[model samples]
Target: MNILITGSTGMVGKNLINHNNAKEYSISGPSSKEINLLDKSKILDWLAKNPTDLIIHCAGLVGGIQANINNQSGFLFNNLQMGINLIDAAYKSGIRNFINLGSSCIYPKNISNEIDESMLLSGKLEETNEGYAIAKISVAKYCQFLSEKGFNYKTIIPCNIYGKYDDFSETGSHMIPGVIARMHKAKINNDNYIEIWGDGKARREFMYAEDLADAIWFCVKNIKQIPKFINVGIGEDFSIKDYYQTISEIVGFKGEFKFNRTKPVGMKRKLICSKIINQLGWMPKFSLNKGISYTYNYYTKEIQN
Candidate 1:
């Protein structure tokens, strides 16, 4: 099979391309320079020349809460445009199999229970990341609408992901990567403390990027049996403080954490239930400690140096 994966340079895309099973298929991961997802013509032209059998749409403008709040318009417009342009172009190119990656942010905020795939758009999204969430929701719905029309396009909503190739910049990193970066720096500099956003009470579910890649490959092999929209996650969550503490232990940061209550924490909790994917004989293999340790190793070797 011939596969085309977007966001090839990003963490998830890189993991997907590097998966052990990826050797079984011919994979083409186009950088934006090769196929700009925001431009329909470019995507169509690339598809025409490439003749792909499956497209895994993983490209997007994603960031942490502060970044999301600061650039709502960019997040909304860029993500929405990329999704629409790619899916439409794929359809036009007669490509039927597509895997649209969605986020846990698409679920409603402040829910006291684990978010299932059915609860998408059930209520208001978290204010901090609402714009990005809205764009993701729109694109997932577009995939569903097309699926109803006899297309094999499916959306896989994964929880927060962090691993190799993740953005660890101060301004753009997600919770795990940001925390890993900060803790590692603190450990290296012998800093006494590090600042955490909010009260460090917000709960989040994160899966290893490589684990998500495994799930995607499983879905690719069994695309016909996959649901229109499915949730892929570790089926558990931890407090922000738990993540910080875990990373601190891995990075050997024996320091105090100061929580700034004034900062915004997007959702009180955002744990997705992976019952469907689990029942379908797919589950994440990495534990939080193991995943974070691997990610920290990657950071020190790849990003820090």
Candidate 2:
């Protein structure tokens, strides 16, 4: 099988490429420099030449809270355009198998318990990242629309993910990487205190990037018919305080942290309801601590080089 993976250098796409062990499939991952996702002509041309039997669409404009607030239009436009172009191109190319990635942020902001796939679009999105979530929701709807016409598009929604190749930007990264980056920099600079936003009570469920990749591959190889939307995660969560403590220990940061109550905590809790996906016999292999340790080691090596 010939497969094409967009966003090849991204956290999720990189893990997907690295962990794919199916000897029967040939995967092609294209970088942004090679094909601009916003350019429909380029996408069409690339697909015409690539001759892929399957396409894994992981490319998107993504970042943390600050970036999302500052670049709302950019997030919405770029992500929506990319999804529309790729799915249309795949449709034109007659590729039957396509996987669309969605964010758990697509859920409503007030959800504090386990989130099931049925809860999507039931309420308003979190205002901070509403633009990005709208784009993702649109893509999922489009896929659903196309499925009725005989297209085999699968949408997998994952909770907050972290691991190697994550964007560690201090101002524009997700929770795990952002915390690690700040704490690591503080430790390296011999800073005495690391400030955390909120009261450290916000809890989140995070799946390692490799585990998400593994889930995707498992879907590709084992499942005969992928659901319209499925949740992939570890099915458990921990408080922000625990995450900080764990990551700080892994990075050897001895300093304490001060929580700023004025800043946003994003969500109170984000646990994945993995009943459907779990029934498929898919389970995450990495524990929170183990994943953090692995990611910290990679981050340290990266900074030294």
lDDT of each: 0.91, 0.87
Q: Write the residue-wise lDDT of candidate 1 on 126-244 in tens digits.
A: 88888898999999999999999999999999999999889999999988998888788788899999998889988988899999999999999989999999999998999999998
TM-score of each: 0.98, 0.96
Candidate 2: lDDT of 202?
A: 85
Candidate 2 lDDT for residue 185: 86
* Candidate 2 residue pairs in backbone clash: none
- TM-score winner: 1
* lDDT value for model 1: 0.91
* Clash pairs (backbone) in predicted model 1: none
Candidate 2 differs from the real structure by a C-alpha RMSD in angstroms, to one decimal, of 1.3
lDDT of 2 at 52: 86
- The backbone clash count of each candidate, in order, is 0, 0
**Sequence-dependent TM-score of model 2:** 0.96
Q: How accurate locally is residue 212 in candidate 1, as Cα lDDT from 0 to 100?
A: 97
- Report the lDDT of model 2 for residue 213: 91
Which candidate tops lDDT?
1
